[model samples]
Target: MQVFGIAEPGAPAEEIEIATPELTGASVLVKITHSGICHSDVHCAEGYFDLGDAGQMPVTDAGAEYPFVLGHEIVGEVVAAGPEAGVEPGDTKYIVYPWIGCGECQPCRDDNENYCIGAKRNLSIALKGGFAREVWVPDSRYLIPVGDLDPAWAATLACSGVTGYAAVSKVLTEEVDRPIAVVGTGGVGLSAVALLAARGHKNIVAADVNEASLENARKAGATATVLTTGADPVTDLVTAGGGKLAGAIDFVNNGATSGLALGAMGIGGKLVSVGLFGGQLAFPTTVMALNQLKIEGNFVGSLPQLRALVDLANSTELPKLPITEAPLEAQTVNDTLQGLAERTVVGRFVMVS
Candidate 1:
């Protein structure tokens, strides 16, 4: 297999030859079809996360080593499954859920592998990412079948979908009937809108400073769009988000976005920060205590939550999220990761194998 990876933070990614193991090993062999470029990948490459905390991370899992292939949003076909694999040959394609978990951890035992805290935890961090001609997933648990859907689009769903779904569902409560506002109109935000619409939630609100992104949000089932440029952007988002907002989701994960989401939330409402964007918010502790407002941090969901999202994808006839693709080798880093950081990419970018 051929792969592109970085040996160190901020290092130039290079094309390298990777050897594929047997069809039946500790991992499953997937014929790579598509992978998405994400801002998280750039962060990892730039060492925003301490590899020292590499404890229980997929990148530092026991069986794999770096130079890490950064992509985690993956969709591909099963060429061969491991010894205890669930599917047989010729089955429909699926996604690599990305978080390779050690099934024995307390979190894993509870099916909360995304929060695994065990020592020497299982991971794909150092493992080869999906930016390759072929890749191997440490376990079949990571694979979710996506038959016939566009691999590129499905790839976006793997990360962005999981992130959005997890964030919204985490803070949402039955107490509020008002609309849910999703800030940032990128892939993750769009997926959040699509998932909410699929769940029959009308009055889904989308906010972005970009016209193109705002237009894209409309296509993703947003009932209203707010361009966040004027003074008092919160007023616009508050109006777009229902009068008494149930929750505000910030997928941009920056301090500015976090603040906006916080400000936009109505009393007793919740603000969930899901993106890795560099931002912080000074909480309204007084209002939070009095109004019962909430601030929650949501990572990707539990496997079952992800499975449910995939199951919904299997049956839903929702409008396809717009996407652009480039061959893995043909891509330049500036266009994908940097584009994400710059908020220049309208939708997801798929690197086809």
Candidate 2:
């Protein structure tokens, strides 16, 4: 198998040939057909969230004798399954839930494996990832079958789509109501807009300086789009809120966007921090106390939730999403990440093997 990964921090993804990895337990070996290039990939490779917060894992040296494959937005076909598995040979396709948990953990037992420390213990290293021709996952639990779905886009559903859906689901479960705002307009942000709209949230606002992204947000069901500019760029968001926002999701975790998303919220409005695209942002504790607002972080969801999302996406009557495919050559892998970093790619970039 040939895999592409970062040889070092701030370095480009290097292509290397290696022996096929052995499957552990119910682990299924997949021939990666198309894996999406995600913004988190850029963050992980670059070292934005490198402080290794409490319970956060530190990234290892990529320049070691072995550089781990660096991809989690994986979609691939099941070529072979282990001794007792769900995925079988010739299955149309499936998406990988990157943040897998050990079955023995308490959280994993409760199906809230997103916080599974045991799973993090194994997959946190830079030695293994999905950016390769063929890779192995610990179990079929990570593979949510997306039969007859667009292979190129289906892989992206694993992370961006799943996370978007889960974030919105959290809002609905909390019975939160009001006009909502999305802080960023990247692929995941746009997907969140679409998912929220599908769930009947029409009073949605999108923020981004880029016209292309703003336009895409509109296509994804954003009722209003705001271009962050000038002093106090959040003014547009507040204006779009028409007094106060019911809720907001900060898909971009920079000072500017987070400020706007939190500032626009009305009392009791929840803010779900989705991404670290722009890195850290400090919120005013006084306002949070005064407004009685609740904030939470979102991670890519579980396999069962992913399956539900797949079912929802399949039931939609609209044309398939604007999914683009690129060959998984050395240059293609390098170009995919570079394009994401430069904000040149609009939709997900699925690498075909």
Candidate 3:
């Protein structure tokens, strides 16, 4: 099988050939057909995350070798399977759950491998990822059938789609019409907005530094959009939130957006931080105590959440965020990573095999 990956930190992805591993136990091999290029992939290629004040946090393991294959949002057809693997080798495609973990861990036992405490088995991180012609999955259980969903869009459900779904689910309240802010209108942010609208939420405020992104947020069902480029961005958000935000999800959980989300919250508001943009957040303890505000961080999502999101996509007409396709090649992968790093990608970029 051939793969494209970062040969060195801060270098463009390059092509490499490797021998196909033999399947065992419940293991299954998938022939890659569609994979989404995410912003996290850019961080993977760069080898470190920017930690605003403290320093850079390296993602590279000292013991791990270079040319790390970076792609997690994956979907493909089953090509080969172990004797116990349930799926058959055919044209049917399934979205692979890339957040693998030690099945013995408590979180994994609870079917929430995204929160696994044991040895990390996450694809694109601890293992070779899906930016290749094929990926070896440990078990067929992680393969969620795509059904009639668009393959390119379905690829995102493994990560961005489910991440958005889980984050939006965290902020749900009985007061469905209350103002809720979605900070950052990137691919995941837009997904959150659409999910909120689909679930009958009446007031959704989308905030972003880019006007173009804000426009796309409106199309995704945001009742109001705030451009966080003015003198008082928090005030802008609060106004867009219909006086005070009932809840907020910071998709770009950087210093500025985090502050904006926290500052605009009303009493009893909740803030769910769901981005790896990287930064330290300092909020007044007194205000948090007085307002009874709750703050938490969210990883991608649980296995069940991914399955639920796929079901929702199949049942509802979720707004299709612009999906641009590029050939799954070394140069194209590098270009997509560069586009993500520069914040130029409007929606999602899917690589086709």
Output the number of the TM-score-best candidate: 3
Error in Å for residue 334 of model 2: 1.6
What is the C-alpha lDDT profile of model 3 across 285-312, one tens digit per residue? Answer: 9999999999988989988999999999
- Which runs of model 1 end up more than 4 angstroms from their true locations? 18-26, 49-65, 86-91, 119-126, 330-335, 338-344
lDDT of 2 by residue, 172-270 (tens): 533334578887776678888888888877588888888888888888788888888757666778787565777888877666677778887788888
Q: How many clashes show up in model 1?
A: 9
Steric clash pairs (candidate 1): 58-123, 58-124, 58-125, 59-125, 59-126, 253-277, 254-279, 255-279, 255-280
Candidates' C-alpha lDDT: 0.72, 0.73, 0.88
Task: Work out how many backbone clashes candidate 2 has.
Answer: 0
TM-score of structure candidate 2: 0.87
Per-residue CA lDDT of model 1 for 1-353, tens digit only, reads 67776666567677887686665644688877787887677676665543322322343333445676778788888887788877665646778887656677898888887786754232236457776666777777778877766778787777778787787687556553477888887667877888777776777788888888788789878898989898888888887765857888888767677777777777778888787655445666786787788878887777887788777877886556667888776255435777776767765678876
Off by over 4 Å in 2: 47-57, 61-66, 121-127, 173-177, 230-235, 317-321
Report how far off residue 144 is in candidate 2 (Å): 2.1
Q: Is candidate 2 or candidate 3 better by lDDT?
A: 3
Enumerate clash totals for all models, in the order shown: 9, 0, 0
Model 1, C-alpha of 296: deviation from truth (Å): 1.1
Residue 333 in candidate 3 has what lDDT? Answer: 87
Best by lDDT: 3
